[model samples]
Target: MNLTRPAGAVLLALALASVPVTAARATTAADEVNYVALGDSYASGTGAGNYSDALCTRSRNAYPALWAAANDPASFSFVACGGAKIPDVLDDQVSALDEDTTLVSLSIGGNDSGFASTMLSCQYSTLSACERALATAGEYVVNELPGELDGLYATVRAEAPDADVVVIGYPHLYKEGGLCLGGLSSAKRTAVNKGSDLLNETIAERAAAAGFAFADGRPAFAGHEICTGDAWISSSNVHPTAEGHASAYLPAFTAAVAGS
Candidate 1:
């Protein structure tokens, strides 16, 4: 009997040996995460209640706090403030990020685009005023916001070179087809929602350009907009409620972080 391997088997062995095997990268453990939450009122959880501080309106129910509570990360610095703009993040919040930061979550660019003021004008002023405000904000979103976001994102990258940054976006404030009383006209609501869409689109595009993950909250709040009876947005200042933070933002951030 001849002790020899089959020619096909030998060829298969040679082929396998020629292929390179790359090891899968190990994922960071939850306990090893050094997360830094940065940005505006949305990130601080202004309307979510259970305030940890009055100044920034940092809520215990905020998505960052909720994630930190659930994961028990090594360190979590929630520096997001209520009225924070891009400059504020550069001047104040970015200080929290460092080389050891494994995770970063941000919800900025709204104030910079004058979203809050637009909403206010839409709510109190005439439809024409609302339209003008939306138009102005739209211009800012298109012309100015991209560069502002690029600068901020670049700073984040430089500070936390090893971290995974996740940028969270705003949701539509009103259910388009839902019935409602006299808060805002259907046209105003639609315009406001359109503004939200534009803002989210800009943020998502910039986040992707910076090699960061984007967590869109629009889908999460589809049926829970302000006009809907079961609203996730607070009536006070159009910010997310505790339920919104817990249900919409928390899950969105969680999924983005996991995928990142």
Candidate 2:
């Protein structure tokens, strides 16, 4: 799929009503069986990546594992790798997915084109520098991440009509003023984070269009933010920490599958 930036860009905002935990509990045995997972490092749990994959990017503490542990599915296939792009997941993730699959969760497209890297380049550089880079990169990510997400979701649905697909969005990258964010500049961090949120909107839109579940990680993780105590995002404040994983994956999977 061509990943060139597109023309139209819109701020992503959606209101999701939380379903009760009891409501999301698996009713039938089948609901907990035949699970398949796909996505990039975030899905695999980077700083959390020991037994997952050989790639240094995967993590043991990542959300998918957290979800797996919570649900205890009979058959689980987690193909989340580090630095995986939309094309990468589409081409390489099929081996881990199959018709018998009852559920699939993924967090992809972040690395499809080096979004975080581009955002980080502006760190402590200068306001103009950060804005210029983010504007350019945001347009690129907005343009490309959507098409990549659309095609991927379309493919995933075709592969597993019965599966409940959980497309997760990244949480807030920066606190309001980037306060208490480890040691990063609030401005640079906010720009990169805002860019991440833009990409997340695309992911949600695609998930909804495809009859899948979209898990929003922002509000649920508001106070914790990135680097705070009980933080879910890593000390780097970019990737999700163990705390972040708990907030995002388990609850999301549970709620999403509850309706599934």
Candidate 3:
């Protein structure tokens, strides 16, 4: 008849309160997801800020990190590295995956296309030279890079057979059919966007062939590309700002995984 909590009840409450929140999260292993992040600078959180590693630049603001935090996956591994190419994923990041993996998010192939060098060449060279450089990159994209993506996606599928592997593509670096300003000329911007489009197409194809979802970020990033003044990409022209990742990349990934 006494309205008092029992000693055992109080002790149990205290014990539960003392246990860390992560333990509570880990307890639901059956409902928890095992997410593995793989790919290049964009996936590595380079411009997202609050880097966990100087070399890899993995950030809490990166899309994968944002997704993990929002979803509270049972376990999450951020292995994506800045400048990682397809081979980098196969050689390093793939080890994080296994039969138990539930999800994967990747942004690669940009570096493989020598994206930075191509952009630099376009920026510094004459119009014809820039055109030629982009043409060459397009050749690699059409001729050689599909095979690389095929092998990478295939390996990811083989390793995590049941996982939803979402392959993320780069954003167009310029606004189309709009007033262009800043560093890149209208012609260069158009060429850059073309190369990006080709890369995205190839990636989407390979993802489809490998039975993975490809998250094309160009449409999501429309009107927000570099030189738009509302750009989500970093000033240096590559990688997304934190807002960019949150706005474009995050939504794309969420929708792809949801549809999957």
Candidate 4:
């Protein structure tokens, strides 16, 4: 059956046939990309300098912000809040996510196991006292924190089912067995660093179990820890510098998301 049609009509028919296919591709691309940031002080860029708000302390120089500036994604939501614990993330931050979200970067679990308090307690304490404090922190990290984190990961997965979640771990505060200038004694520094290792290990395991990516800051923050003259971590001994976020954390996160 070779019924001849006008050239215009034939062209119109071909165009109509292509519309649905083109639309499908566009939808897929749109649904799979919009970066969302979520987590605690580190993620919020507390010590990175330029604050978005006093409440969150989200620095414009944070890794998520830097990544967005570089990649120019279709959209970006920086919902990470300083001092956010796992429970707070569940309650507050998950609202930023939806099915369409395709990327997520998180730096939580520090506050969950009382990282700041542990460090504070280590100050003005003997080696024995510092070790005891670290032991307590390590117990919480291994024994209770994983389940809490797993529950949060489940919630995040449910909210943005298809998003590539990259879980970032804390940096070791001081060089192991190095001379520390801060109030922390050598023993305290060693203990705190050990606690940091334990936390990172637990976080990496949970991320693996949940099919998420883990961005390790240990190697990146290696030469730039607290006691080092060119430390990337802040004087407060907790958060990263603007340079830290831009260089170390940003690269680690971008690599993870790209690999995914």
Candidate 5:
């Protein structure tokens, strides 16, 4: 999509200037470190204008592949199927984890609480009803997300104790006070958009408690909101365009893990 560098990206580049560079040598005897990604649709690269399978569940330019490419790891597997819940992580993630794994990234929990499904429902309901749905989803994240995260982390760590784990937070829904037309009104669309921040904050706090790094996508998309110029977020509320993916992901991901 030919994404240009956002203006503030210079600031990120400047911050990146300070970190010491690491030589990309083989880390293990087999010579390549493995990287595994687990999570839901966001991690699967939805709305990024690219997919690897019919379910449209996998993205060709998923952040894991992007991060792994920068790290130049020995092997990488994006077992991040779409609509994966915490249970999926605990049970299905093993196929992706192995002794060679040195890095991991997770973006999950929206599905377990049914945010996607509920959001779809919100589109048809009145504002009060939509808010109620959001509140319910919030309750689940506030209450159950932690347990799910803890379990998933425990499982991932058990499989790859030495891996550096990073969790990518969900992006903002749209331009602040912006408008979009779907089954919902512009105001309701904005409301749902703002709800994502609450979700990210909770996710970040839990990630910190779990001792994992976070690739914050909020500030990266500040000013530039969904369905806008060089927009990093998709018009559909949750997906990201290829351009959006690169802008939202790039520098922060490298800053958190390996630097360019």
Candidate 6:
């Protein structure tokens, strides 16, 4: 028996046969991640130490650097800077992103909310003064920060349309019930931690609204908060230590990316 095939069917079959299967195997952004790390001090690994660049304080021990080293993605751009505010990120870092970018990780807004000043007041001044600073920072976080984050997140999404953006949140600085000889008082520590929670919540909400993944660093640094003997955060600076970046932020970021 002889089979007769339509001319159109035969032509289509030949055309399909001529195409290489390997051509269809061209890698996507996911298959070959072109990651761009952006944000402020936390993202730059300030207290983690072993800084590679003096200006940005871009530490090799930072979570972004560590992840890049471990995963060895197709490309990694570490543009996070110490003391980077929302405006700074918009002006400087967002330029690193483009259509080819697949992954992005950042922790921002703390600087914008005057977190450093608030912490300084809490550390050096009276409890009343600390409360005042906390109130100011909380007010900014609630009132001003959401709009800034929305603008920044919109810019990021516009630049890296296909990237899996992960917005990392700050960890609570102190272990509430833990012992400390003569640093911040328990009440001060509690207030600061609550402030940190509020900041994280604000960031999380904005990230969610922008369709970005939010990585909560609080749980990751749970037992390792500043007052804990085995603290992962630096007591002096209230920034994550090397171990904190390695164990806490790194895992939090990795998990967020995986889930994303």
Best by the lDDT measure: 6
* Candidate with more favorable, higher TM-score: 3 or 4: 4
lDDT of each: 0.92, 0.70, 0.87, 0.87, 0.73, 0.93
Clashes of each: 0, 11, 0, 0, 1, 0
lDDT of 3 by residue, 28-101 (tens): 66466899999999898888899988899888899999999999888899999998988889999999999899
* lDDT tens per residue, model 1, 1-260: 55366877898887887654321123334337899999999999999989998899999999999999999998989999999999999999899999999999999999999877888899999999999999999999999999999999999999999999999999999878645686788888898999999999999999999999999999988889898889999766899999999999999999999999
In model 5, pairs of residues that clash are 232-244
lDDT of 4 by residue, 39-119 (tens): 998998999988887789998999989999998888899999999999899999999999888899988898888877777
Would you estimate the TM-scores of all the predictions? 0.88, 0.80, 0.86, 0.91, 0.80, 0.91
Candidate 1 off by > 4 Å = 1-31
Worst 10 residues of 5 by lDDT: 20-29
List candidate 5 segments past 4 Å from native: 1-32, 178-186
How do the residues 2-107 of candidate 5 rate in per-residue lDDT, one tens digit apiece?
Answer: 3456656877887687553322222244355677878888777877746776483687777766766667777788888787888887777766786668778888
lDDT of 2 by residue, 59-170 (tens): 6666677767776888877787777888788889856776778889888766765656565666556767777877876776777767777788888888877777888777
Model with the higher lDDT, candidate 4 or 6? 6
Which pairs of residues clash in candidate 3, taking residues 3 or more apart in a chain or in different chains?
Answer: none
- Residue 253, model 3, lDDT: 91
Candidate 6 whole-model C-alpha lDDT, 0 to 1: 0.93
Clashes of 6: 0
TM-score of 4: 0.91
lDDT tens readout by residue for model 6, 1-260:
44466777899888897675545556342399899999999999998889998899899999999999999999999999999999999999999999999999989999999988888899899999999999999999999999999999999999999899999999999988655787788898899999999999999999999999999999999999887889999998889999999999999999999999
What shift in Å separates residue 102 of candidate 4 from its native position after superposition? 0.7
lDDT of 1 at 217: 91
What overall lDDT, based on C-alpha atoms, would model 4 receive against the true structure? 0.87
